[model samples]
Target: MDELAALTKLERVYRESSLLCFTETWLKQDIPDSVISLTGFTLVRADRSEVESGSSDHNLVNLLPVYTPVVKQQSPQGKEVMIWTEEASEQLRDCFNITDWDVLCSPHGEDVDSLIHCVTDYIHFCVENTVPSRTVWCFPNNKPWVTSELKALLNEKKRAFLSEDKEELRRVQRELKYNIRRCKASYKKKLEQGMEQNNIREVWRGLKHISGHGKSGDVLQVIGDQAWANELNLFFNRFDLARHRAPSSLPSRQAIHPQLSSFTPQLPAQHSALLPTVTVDQSTVDQSTSTPFRLTLDQVRRELKKTKARKATGPDNISSRLLRECADQLCEVVLFMFNLSLSLERVPALWKTSCVVPVPKISHPKELNHYRPIVLTSHLMKAMERIVLSYLRTQLVHL
Candidate 1:
């Protein structure tokens, strides 16, 4: 206990441990609990001599707590049919004051831009009205195995501690410790039984807790790199050796004009002379001015089929599951919007808005280069792009 107190006074890097076993502690029966307590850890043992033979035991203490997990009761599972998306869509219609089928079939139903705006508004409504999940416990919570009996014993121990009743505190502390250890043993036994009966989930849950699956990573003790961040930064910055692009603003879309005709010696009015020259056939110009590829119902259906369910939404909080579920009816409307977007040669601003999440490549990543960006954009816009890309690939293959 004296050695443990001395060790606690010294600075240490990390202290969280799931299990700590103590061997020999030359502890006397007259020792007080207040002198041998660890603030944040649970006591597992003192010594065999003190408990069994009532003789003084002399050995060092190792402070460790082994947690045993028991099974948790759960409700039966059932199929969940969610209506948030449909309600959101209906809300969108109400916001636009449009009747059913009007926007999809009406000739004057604004363009893709208008449809995107309505969708974005609906997403906002859904997010604003949705309820957030609740947490059952806060940080520094008691262990799951702690019970009412243990809690009452703890209160008695506390009072004895506060009153400076050393002998009484030691007795109460010993009882409290014994009960907690017995409870943990029972919990561990229950887990072993569950495993023997093929309860995989319960077994895994207990194992994860025992292994400290969600605990914070221990910081590395390198001389300069700290927790791998410094070395990672050095490795990532080596690629910035030279500039790849000119340090000037560039045109967003530079016009490309294929040389229609190369100027050469024109046949002098009187002197008939023919010089070889490159020329553009009429067919080349016709292809350049050709309309944007028209999206078909089948193409829309194929794109919708590729949509994934229950994915994170983008700026427009609409879910992919919603589109995939009602693909048959929604494809016609989405296809009409897509065709209009193609003919007009413009993509809506809403379609361009994206949500970017930066994910770290390694533990304790520091620099911007250490993170990879994941951009989430409009699902509808992606579908339309897929169709255009498909058409372009077909043309390239023929070429």
Candidate 2:
């Protein structure tokens, strides 16, 4: 009814005009054309099928191309993510320091897996409770240097437009342009600084940001398509040995050396007597010399401190930044876990598992060969491995 009233007004305003056309009326087949019929024009209707069929000819006369303006669709904003700042780190450290780990993480009969899981869960809980976070609207074409001030200015511009303040809107537009230039200059300077410091990673990251190439482009979206994922899995594991084939048995020493098999002979009595026998008392030997090396608080602390804060977390969801920041509080528990693992001669199952991220080798990847797998393992496990490696190197030097 409102549409009909608008049409009547349009007819009155354009009394001398002959033709008026409307696209995308969204009118249903059941809606009669008489309801929306204009006063002086003949009612004509062209549905989607008619339009498509009429436009199918390639040699049609005066067929001017109609280019509709492309409107970018904004993606839905994601959930609020934690922001790790100095204050948040301090709060997390305090949380770790105040917690009684002995009471909170009482493992069931020295189960290393249970102990690790409990500790990780508690740490994650503390982080969630203590860390500061904010919702960030991530635009597809957003620049790396777009700060909060610029976002505020954009909002102000919108408000000015809504309020019909031309002067205010123009002022905001000028300010936004200036800030955008400043931000670009600042970002360029930072990239130059990174280059001067010989930080290849940061330089590459900045280059990618400038080129508008994001990490999202590298991800293969095979969610809910199990067949494609299975195909990729099979392609990745193409070189693996077939499970049905049993491994060939290794040849015996005698079989490897045919001459030795038939040439076995007993040593002469005189030569056997010449070989002097030397035996030492077992009680005289030092037993302490053969004891296994145990991990110390300092060793664990050193390894934790060495962890790079910017590195991605593993399957456990334990960030390297958390371990590095709270090394002092984490050292004792880690040391205990390390010693327990050594004593039992078994590592935690959680440490063995890793999250594999497939990174594309090309811009447009279509096959398995175009991707390389990057495995993210536990940071604590890496630290423990480093400790063992250092110990082995020290022992090797002494030998």
Candidate 3:
């Protein structure tokens, strides 16, 4: 409704055009006709649930090309998407008033009351702004890797091919071949450099481009909420999208007990009863060898700094880049939320939700099981988990 209202404001743009199409209208039967009525155009759409009902309610965007007598454009394609790239990154920084820092250190102080005040303000700011977004539009790559000189030569070669000039065709073909070789070599060298730097994300991005999977697919055909939930459990109970691996080495008891697969070892009954006798020296506490007493601003900051900026976000729709950029101020809110949850022994309802994405793991996978699920959780929830993890780590020492 917001979009259609905005489009109505642009009467001149649509009035001048012959045909206008919306691929992702978010329209359903529940929406009243009055809601979608536009002055200068008719709307045609298909809902995901209605399209080929045998399949899951996914990828259901009805696409029709924007028609205009003014140009030869036809064939509507692609779903609506918010692509996180340099453009989106710049927009986030501008919207949040984040500045470039020489060091990505988090803000800290010993006073909890003061931290809570800062956090309350930050939460209000987020609620007012909502999540920063810019819809991505697919455009042809007019800027080719080939030089202008080579392009001119290619045009001449095209003229030769059309005019049946055999000698000119042969000469042009040789030059084109050399240019192609140079382009491939240059691209290959860049890929090698990314790999050598251990830039896994960069290397993976280049591979996606090489495999012709860089383009975004139909957004209208997106996975439904229920599907995302089931898939989240399937992926995240084990947490694959995180790519977190367990330690290979195991304690003697765990190694010998098959039931202890991924479970933490517990102290025997005799030892459990005597835990009160243990003593600790606060001055001798070493983070390198012991669990933290509580989550610190520094711990949250370290985790955010190490996290990838471009990965997908969860129910809150907060991007990793946004979290990392605002870490200095945001850590307070995160720490506060963690402490509140711990004290109350209850989590926010939103934290319980997730966004599950299906990624094709194998080529030409026909079975539903072939698709791998990648689960994304709320950034706030992750922070809460990290805090709990500190407690777990301390407790595990007894076993």
Candidate 4:
């Protein structure tokens, strides 16, 4: 509405003015009717090509052009002379004001280069030649003093620009801080909640499933669960892309257990005929040994119970957890037998010291071989034990 009102006022002013200047009116020659309806300014077809080529929009004045009157005066003895009227002379003087020209030429910091060059050329032309001063028509709404007023207006403009820049900087900083803090807090909180570690075995299985060669089917068809499907598909796509860029040595699904079959059986009579059986003296072997080695599972379990009781009464320390973990790993390795001999007794202690876990003797339905079972890595066993313990502890604490 404000724009419409302003346009109306401009049209009125332009119609009242005695001088008019236009540009780019040639292309809009047929648009004269629309212009007249909109602005009520008279359009005159002053040139031939403008009408023929419909180029009236350019170099076409809608208003009358202002002109200076040519006057003649007779001097004494029939001598004739011409001089401008007082009004014309005053208009000329106003247009050629040296002070106005100086002001126009003065340095405005914002537009220093091009504006200075233009003003310098203009002032030089006026000073060096007999130049007649005349006022050029501007658009009715165009501010004639825009060039001279630029420096004064720039003070507030610069302040506004700086203020806007500062605000934008503050906005961006706030967004950055929020995103970074949110991401960090989410990562740490998920760690504390044990989300990633709890599902690690499943994650490994999903990774294996994604390697189509291992799973023997497409991920979507193999994993019926929607969440698992999504995760598997995403990981598989990532793996495929990464593999294309740089191939990774992915581990194969071949079982790492040794089979105890494929051997020819020897007959008892042949075995007896081939060699003589010999037995070593146990007394000599025991005498030669320096260490007593009298450790038992009961004694080890007793040590564990004592440590737990002590830690229950006091705050748990890092060393305490380490020892507890060692005890757990010791238990995981040793399989109990009713014979209760030195082999059974030495197993747990040596297992603990050796830092090795025995192969899991699981009899799951998924097992392919009855004699051989999978040997899990020590690291994997330890990590699994830690995760389960921590998860149970967290649940208990919550309860």
Question: What is the C-alpha lDDT profile of model 3 across 1-399, one tens digit per residue?
Answer: 544444435544433444444434455556554544465555443344564322333222222334444213323344544445665555545644553221221354343344434554454365345444454333333223455566678898889986778998999999899887887787778778989998888789778765656444311233448775565465545555456675576668556887765586566799888777757654445643464345678887776665667677777666576677666655655665566555555565667776766676665555556667677787666766766687679666754
Worst 10 residues of 1 by lDDT: 68-77
Clashes, model 3: 5
Per residue, candidate 4 scores C-alpha lDDT tens digits across 276-395 of 756666665565455443335554433443343123111111223223433433332221211122333322221122121122134332222212322222222233334336545744
**78-121 per-residue lDDT for model 2 (tens digits):** 67777988898888888888888788556445888888888788
Q: What TM-score, computed on C-alpha atoms, does each candidate reach? A: 0.44, 0.67, 0.42, 0.16
The numbered model that scores best in lDDT is 2
Candidate 4 Cα errors over 4 Å, as ranges: 1-271, 285-292, 295-321, 324-399
Superposed model 3: Cα runs more than 4 Å off:
1-135, 139-189, 195-200, 211-294, 359-371
What is the overall TM-score of model 1 with all chains considered together? 0.44
Cα lDDT computed for each candidate against the true fold: 0.61, 0.74, 0.57, 0.38
Relative to the true structure, candidate 2 reaches a TM of 0.67
**Top-scoring candidate (TM-score):** 2
What TM-score number comes out for model 3?
Answer: 0.42
* Local error of candidate 1 at residue 260 (angstroms): 34
Write the number of the candidate with greater TM-score, choosing between 1 and 4: 1
lDDT assessment of candidate 4: 0.38
On a 0 to 100 scale, what is the lDDT of residue 141 in model 1? 37
